[model samples]
Target chain A: MMFLSFVKKEFLHIFRDPRTMLITLGMPVAQIILFGFAITTEVKNVRMAVFDPSHDISTQRIISRMQASEYFDMTQVLHTADDINSAFNKGKAELVAVFSDRFDENLLRAGKASVQLIADATDPNQAAMLTAYASNIIADYRQELLREHRIPFLIEPEIQMLYNPQMKSAYNFVPGVMGLILTLICAMMTSIAIVREKEVGTMEALLVSPLRPVWIILAKVAPYFTLSIVNIISILLLSVFVLDVPVSGSMFWLAVVALMFIIVALLLGIVISSVATTQVTAMLASGMLLMMPVLLLSGMIFPIENMPVILQWISNIIPARWFITAVRKVMIEGLGVSYVAKELAILAGMAVFLIAVSVKTFKIRLS
Target chain B: MKKAIEVENLTKRFGSFTAVNAISFDVAQGEIFGFLGANGAGKTTAMRMLCGLSRPTSGKGAVAGFDMIRQPEEIKRHIGYMSQRFSLYEDLAVWENIRLFAGIYGVPEKEIAPRTDGMLARIGFESGRNTRVKELPLGWKQKLSFAVAIFHEPKIVFLDEPTGGVDPLTRRRFWEMIYDAADRGISVFVTTHYMDEAEYCNRVSIMVDGRIDALDTPKNLKQQFGVRSMDEVFHRLARENALTSNAN
Candidate 1:
């Protein structure tokens, strides 16, 4: 009864403002479209500078084939191997293809040839994609040789996903996008809403009313919890329909676990609102502070195994990491609910701990 | 008259400093009790303790027949509070703000609309119930805030500087509303830094350095202090306290 009015008032706050509506509903789609399309995980249109010493038929054919495909553009033709550094430094090319002096002769006589791909590894993901594209193109040339001249010297291993067997970039990152968007929207929005009441002095008014402090905090978070669930549903729809990333696992488990993570995020917002006296403080506390760790340490973009051992250990405490991990298992790997039990346990533990901390602080604030 | 509030040795200490130091007072039902103080004289602190917004460091008090310490939540059900800062959601319409506060106070769902309309009618604010609170003038906002505070008809209502930053004419009108609430047997415990407003109360208590320096009717206080007005009475009390502190 009283709780319903509090929840209704919270909804009124969100709906009466246009910007809040956009941020709560539109942010997920915009971020997903931007990440899905603009930040491409699969490399294409990569500019390449060649350092071909013995410009033989095989070398010419391989370069032309790579250029003919949509993946690579042979941008600069270099005179010597010494030009590789300058070509990379000039930034005209993301990668330089350097072939050994006797490229075709070694292939014909010794069944061996070397083509070194040097790429800018500053963005490790793009660098890896560039090298992968280059090797795949070279292996294609090797395939043609075996079919035409009966020579076989290469083996190509394909990258595949169970749902998206062709390994679409969207398939790889949809879970990650879900992790980033839900954590930020749920935590930041909930905190700002609660802190706004404090800033406006209505919180003190509500506190002095017959309503319990626990009910007040719950009312503040309830609307955002509902909104975040809306966000999760829309994100899943966009992943499946727009981005072509299928959820191969049971939908029930996926929704259940996502709701659990939202609880953690919302509770985090409550704790933040308890410490913050102003809306701006709450925003910075939940928005920028939560973002860096969520984006970097959550294993959303960077793999946890590739990180330093200390960083890997540190990532364990970040709630988003467990969420993204569980999402990948359920959405991409087609795993069962039992597979995410450990992740579910961690998130539930976080929710309970935050609940206890918020309750303690709430009682302290009352006194 | 029955006592609406009673307190003895109500002290609130923030570490080494006591904000409200062993203050004691009471308000009879239907009385307009004024709490006057200088800046940081701890009037707000004592009011918060009575309203169940804060726990006293040590002491005892009862608000609306409930123990302030052991039954803070119970005390909340029987009292209304208006903060020093304007307490309505500025973005909400007048009726919406009324509904929200009334509903939170646990007014029956069916009674909210009629009571809202009745209060608006009595205030003679017709046809602007849909106006957002921010769009309303400061004077009207203050009136609406008072109306909402007592809308649930709590036995006692605490007003913390309810008329700061309003004009004299508008302040008079606002006090008329307060007088009407008190006439309905609602105890009004109000605090103000403005000495002139203290004259409007049935009984005024001047707080100086966390203590009630004087408690009496306006006429009695002036007669006792050999002063002409509540303003002079307040100045003499504060100035004497300043002189004592300087000597110490």
Candidate 2:
């Protein structure tokens, strides 16, 4: 009963402040949309080539669709698999869309088909965006095929983004955005909300009450926890609908894993609030101590593998690194729960360790 | 009268510094017990020990019959507290603040609304129940906080320097509220450096350099110190420590 009051009070604190409400809800939508469109390497009217050996109706339809889209203008038709490499080497075409043999026959017979997109990856950003657009077109075509026919037609665009790949931006950013926003909202906001009470001296009145310290911390966490879940849902929705990122894996497992990530971030917040006496200190600590690591080291911006060996080792310990990896597997790679078991275990361990640390460190008495 | 508090040899110390040293006292039911000291005179440290906020280094204490050390949580449930600084939610309306604290203090849900009305009426703040606490005058804010503190009817309430910077008028009005709470049989454990406020307490314990050097009613303390007022009594006690520290 007392716990309910504490939760209600925290909710009031969040609701009463308009700035907090805006930052909590408005910031994520703006960021994902901005990153999806504004800070993009998206280029238009790219020269393209097709290696459609089958030249069947399915292949012709996809080729015409690719040409009709605003992003691609087909300039050549290659006849050999070997021509894909030379076409890029000779600056003949920026991309090569290679359809499999007997494309329409195989697609109708097996309800599955493949289209290999190869791109000039000398500029990884341009390469990422080109593939993202190309793949989005294919995904839309595949959706049309599913609507027209009853079979589960899997038109898997084989993304050798190592060479060329749509939502390559999606694959990279949707998870990155989730990691960044969750950290900002859960870790930073939770700590600030808690430290604000301490700064106002209300904590003394609270500590003296029958409400247990854990209950107080939980109540503080509860609101942000709910907010972050909302953020997660919205970001995922935006990714699927606006950004065209696929929820290839199980949606239920994706949500479950994301919820675990939220817990880890929220626990980090509790740990930070345990140490920070004021809101400024909490925010700076969260920024310096949590955000920097999440941004630079979580493979959110820079790939962890390409980082220096020591930095790679350090990145392994950053919670977002694990969260992004888990999300990528569950969301983009279309993997199952068992695939992300290690990441989930590590996140669960972090949650437990943080809970223990917060318990030990949270002050019961004022200095 | 039943005892609201009992303690013996309460001492709290840092590594090499003793902030509260072997101090002990008792408060009868419904009495206003003033914990008197200058700034940094160990009064807060001692009170924190009794309130179960700070663990005593070595002491025995009980708040409202609950053992302070072993059952601090139980003691917390039975006692009320107001911090040295203003502690109400500035953004929340007065009625919201009341409902929040009342609920947190485990006031029966059924009694909360009616009691909240009663509290607002008693504090003469019925019309402004919807006023955000930050907009209220600081003095009235303090009064509202005090009313809320005792709203759950805890056996004892520990207030730490509640009137630190209030004007004389507000301080007097604050004291009137304290007297009113005392009449209804709630023990008030208040800490203050104000010598004049000491005169209003049923009993006052004056601490100098971490020890309670004088514990008596204001009239008796004035008589024992051969002084005319509680201010003179305090100076007489603090002056000796001042001289000794200066000599060292």
Candidate 3:
């Protein structure tokens, strides 16, 4: 009964305070839309230069096709292939496409043409994508030309997309959004609540109560756990209905894993509250301490494999990385529990360690 | 009558600063015992030690029939505390605050409702049970805070300047509530700088320079200091201490 009343009171506070409402709900929506549209791994609208040495009908048609594609915006039609290096050096173009000399002679004689694509490889992923898109356009043009003359190739490479076959950005983002939202709700909110109690001087009342420090800490965090679960359900509903994001695994399993993550987050929040003296300090600490790790290292934005070795090692310690991995396996890949046992066990161990640390810190502070 | 609280040479130090220097006192059940001192005279530190919020550097003590140092949790279960500031949740309604406190104290659900209703009526706050604590006047909030502090019927209630900033009329009404609690055999360990309020206590102790200089009934303190009131007695003792310091 006491626990229920405490939970009810916490909910009342969350409802009454406009700041809490804004941070919990408004910020989640804003971040989702921001990351969905603006902050993305896939680069777009790359500038390019076309060095068409052939100057023939087929070469011009391919150039036109590349321009029509949304991925590339051809801002310049170069006069010389030598200008490619200068254009890229001056940051005018990220990619340059060149066709061999002989105009239409080679294509007419051998029924084949060679094109060289040059890209600024500073950002390797962007360069790779640009190269792939340019090549695909050339391939399409070649296939069309051959079909016009009824020519057929003896050998062809059949294309297949193994993972993320649909290539829908939403499918990639659902797991990320789950990690960010759950961590913020369970960790940041609880820290703020604990610091607020200390600020208002009511913590002294609880400290003086017959309630043990461990019980008090548990009671303080219990409400946020409940709310975070509710938020998880809300996000799931929004993902399925609004975003049309699919969950391939068991919903029950997903919920169980998410609850375990929430528990870990709550313990982390308690540890933060123990070190912070005020609400502002706690909020800043949680944001810098937890949010940054989740954002950068959780495989939500950056690919951990492509990162520097040092950074990859750094990412290994971030709890959100493991949770996001688990979630994606269950949701996107539809992997079973047996397949994700290692990640789940690591998360469970992390939760236990965090709870133990929080308990020790709470007891020390009480003493 | 059993002693509700007892302390012998109870001391508390904060690093190099001696906040409470070997303070000693006793409170009988159903008695109003006041610890009187000027600001920073260590009244709070001593009271916190008795309330089991702060540890004493040295000495032994017992509160509410339990050892204060070895078994703080037990002492907590048997006592209530209302800090100098109004510590109740400002966003919570009067009845909700009552319910929350009662709940935290582990009051059974079936009895909480009636007890809360009865408490609100007894405090003459039945009409405003739904009002948020922040919206109420300072006096009303102080009264409400006091009622919440003792709602669990702990063996002893600690009021650390509970009447600060309250008007005289409200302070009197608050004392009436305190007196009623005391009459029910609940000891009151109150600390206040209000010289007028000191007269209401069954026994009063005045501290100077982190040490209790005098402890006695109000009449005895007045007679021993050859003063007409507790204020004059306090003034005389403080003036004497200042003179001794100057001589040193």
DockQ, per model, reads 0.78, 0.49, 0.62
Which regions in candidate 3 have their CA more than 4 angstroms from the true location? A18-46, A51-57, A64-72, A76-91, A94-106, A114-169, A249-253, A308-310, A336-342, B13-19, B38-40, B55-58, B226-248
Pick out the ten consecutive residues of candidate 3 chain B with the lowest summed lDDT.
Answer: B44-53
Model 1, residue B174: distance off in Å is 0.5
Q: Write the per-residue lDDT of candidate 1 for residues A1-367, one digit (tens) a residue.
A: 8888878988898999999999888899998898777766667788888888989998999889878988888899999766877777778877788787778888887777888777765455576687788888888889888888787664332221111122324465778778787777788888888889899888888888999988888888888888888888898899889878888999988998898998898888889999999999998888767878888888776667668999999899989999988988998989998999999999999999999999999888877
What TM-score would each prediction reach against the true structure?
0.89, 0.81, 0.84
Off by over 4 Å in 1: A40-45, A49-57, A64-93, A96-102, A109-168, A308-313
lDDT minimum window of 10 residues, candidate 1 chain B: B83-92
lDDT of 1 by residue, B1-248 (tens): 66899999999999999899888889999999998898899988888889888889998989998998899988999999897677899878898889888888889999998888899899999788999998989899889889999999999999988888988888899999999999999999999877778889999998899999999999999999998988899889989999999999
lDDT of 2 at A292: 95
Candidate 3 lDDT score relative to the true structure? 0.82
The global C-alpha lDDT for each of the candidates, from Candidate 1 onward, is 0.85, 0.87, 0.82
- Candidate 1 docking band: medium
lDDT of 1 at A99: 80
Between the candidate structures 1 and 2, which one is better when assessed by DockQ?
1
**Prediction 2: B-chain TM-score:** 0.97
True contacts kept of 2: 0.88
Q: What is the TM-score of chain B in candidate 1?
A: 0.97
